[model samples]
Target: MMPLSMVASGETVRLIAVRGGRGICFRLAELGLVPGATFQVIQGSGQGPLILAFGETRLALGRGMAHKIYVESFMRGGQECQNN
Candidate 1:
């Protein structure tokens, strides 16, 4: 598994776990980042920030912050859900 920050542009991944204190964990959860949730890396600013989409919301996160969020890469057509 790679940290969410490591996800490349246009790549998709699944939320596996979060490594951080309760406050940071709660912050991520409130942003719709949770176990099993899938998201795509829309863009990554060279400095550190990344833009991601989960469900219908788009969020931007810094690399230092994203490193605390662990994720696993998912291939296209790996899993199907009623929603896209």
Candidate 2:
């Protein structure tokens, strides 16, 4: 598993785990970031907020918050990355 922040822009990734205190986890979960959730990284850089797309909703997650969320990036046709 890798930090959500490391995912490439425009790639769809599956949420694997969320690391942090209960408050953080609760906040993320409230935003629909629970484990097994799938979302596409709308935008990402080493700086600024990371934008994630879940269906029609878009959420801007701070870099620090994003780092605490781990994910598994998947390719087209729902194939997971073997190199991870």
Candidate 3:
């Protein structure tokens, strides 16, 4: 797993876990960020807040906070998941 801050732009990733305190977790969850949710990176390069698209909503997450979010490729295996 990798931090959300490291995910390449245009990649769709699934949230795995949060490695922060309760307060932080709650705050992020309130913004629609939680385990199992999927998100696409708009901008991320291990610097600054990450600009991510969570469905129709756009979220800007600070680098520190972004680092707390662990994710994996949303696609199963090495292939991209297809839309039905």
Model 1 TM-score (2 dp): 0.81
Score every model by TM-score. 0.81, 0.85, 0.85
Candidate 1 overall lDDT versus native: 0.77
Error of 1 at 14 (Å): 0.3
C-alpha RMSD (angstroms) for model 3 = 5.8
Which 10 residues in a row give candidate 1 its minimum summed lDDT?
75-84
Q: Any residue pairs clashing in model 3, and if so which?
A: none
lDDT of 1 at 53: 82
Top-scoring candidate (TM-score) = 3
The lDDT values for all models are 0.77, 0.81, 0.82
Badly placed stretches (over 4 Å) of model 2 are 76-84
Ranking by lDDT: 3, 2, 1
Candidate 2 C-alpha lDDT tens digits along 1-84 = 788888889889888778889998889889887777889999975788999999799999999988988888655334332321
Name the TM-score of candidate 2: 0.85
Candidate 3 whole-model C-alpha lDDT, 0 to 1: 0.82
Candidate 3 C-alpha error for residue 60, in Å = 0.5
Candidate that beats the other on lDDT, 1 or 3, i.e. the better one: 3
Off by over 4 Å in 3: 77-84
